[model samples]
Target: MIVFQQRYPVAFTIAACLVCGSAVAQSAIEHHVWQDKRKFEPYSRTAKSITGAIRLSGNPDFATPGSKMTMTFGNGKKVGLTSVGASWRQWDETDDKKATAEAFKLSRDPGHLRNGNTLCGDPQSDPAQYVVFLERSTFGDSTRLLGMAVFGSKEVPHDINSQSLCGTFSYSTD
Candidate 1:
């Protein structure tokens, strides 16, 4: 009976290893350069663009905050983005489940005053706030929406803090 029990555990261990190995083999990694556009209202202040790069891993999960990212513009300008917040949305046949990985406010040294309050909504909400969406793609890397709202302390007429898609993007596992 002792020998049978020992063999059973060994078999279980082998089976577990095989399952985990298969999952790792099926997973993949990719990077994407994305272009986004944002248009504001009233005065028709239109067409602001930003180019960004994202590195994505398989299993359709969202990336964690502080996962190094960079953005470039049309005139050969570039900036590194420090991800302050991230939320993952899992889609089923009927509904979606959202999970927040990090919750914090973003503040640029010069302040992002292009399209006020367009990307991220009210900042007063507890646990922070995020908008997540899943886009159709042949590549495993999906589209993620991120933003925040900045209230002017005393000066400025509450300009919207935002970034939009612009320029070409490439995807690769390497």
Candidate 2:
């Protein structure tokens, strides 16, 4: 295509509109840095989400019983996080299943809360909300509490932002 838009004109117009097919409704995190800038790709949308065994928040007796979690959402759901520590930097806004992710479900659910604890009756969050520590904590209390996320506006389920978001959060005991 004209030598890739004269040698990469912004990654050839975003990879020629994602390979020029038309029907574009995709973005669970797919940025080839505009094109081959590498890293960041998780766009598998056949609407596949079925689940069980999603434990995060650590210290559940040294957490070791069918653990798994993977998550990333942007461009519409807009959230992909992982700071790697600080008990995921608590931010508990009276818990509403962590405020999003469709009331945090799929069966056996109990993982979502970035209300970032204001301590005892929590209120007053935003501790640099940008969490994405997918399925961590194999004991030793590294505390990367499963699939928690935040970046742009995590005020809580006061309304909007919850389209069953998940890249691949697996933790099945079935």
Candidate 3:
């Protein structure tokens, strides 16, 4: 197991491998976000805002083809770009920053549907592009699946669940 703590961002990341008997079977990533209310203390432990875990296991023989699973919180909120019907290359990867930038531009092309501040695009017509832009502005550098939270609050974050997509994409509040 490996653990890394970042001070400024108040993030704690844990990477570990699971072993059954003598052989390792799976690896997991656990991330925790903390909100500090201390002024003098730099490393003050505070209330935890979120906790996320990603685990991968099983063999190809037992794995289902074309199967995909998106992460969701205990509050019934979906996490990561996949939740918004976007791919890793289109949103988080450093190698595909160009594609990510292009998607941000096209999202505000004036033809896309708008729900409050978010921009909704057609995932079919624009493959690799963001199907749902949470906000009208450009995507942030720090914004990624690991660092993002959706529906984290008791109040509805946005109307994306109610707004119609390009008909190819669908979202649910439940």
lDDT of each: 0.30, 0.28, 0.23
* C-alpha TM-scores of all predictions: 0.29, 0.17, 0.18
Top candidate when judged by lDDT against the true structure: 1
Q: Write the per-residue lDDT of candidate 1 for residues 1-174, one digit (tens) a residue.
A: 567658798887788799999987854553211212221111111213222222222212234455433333223333344444343433211223432332222232221224442222233332112212222232255533332222222222111222221111222212
If the candidates were sorted by their TM-score against the true structure, best first, what order would they fall in?
1, 3, 2
Error of 2 at 141 (Å): 25
RMSD of candidate 2 to the truth, in angstroms, is 18.0
Better of 1 and 2 by lDDT: 1
Which of 1 and 2 is the better model by TM-score? 1
Model 1 stretches astray by more than 4 angstroms: 1-3, 6-64, 90-135, 138-174
Model 3, span 64-101: residue lDDT tens:
22323333222333322222222223322223242221
What does candidate 1 score on TM?
0.29
- Per-residue alpha-carbon lDDT of candidate 2 for residues 1-174, written as tens digits (9 for 90 to 100): 798789889998887787774556655542111111112322122112222222232221111223222232222222222222222222232233331121121121212222222111212332322223223232364533233333223322222233222233322111
Q: Quote model 3's TM-score.
A: 0.18
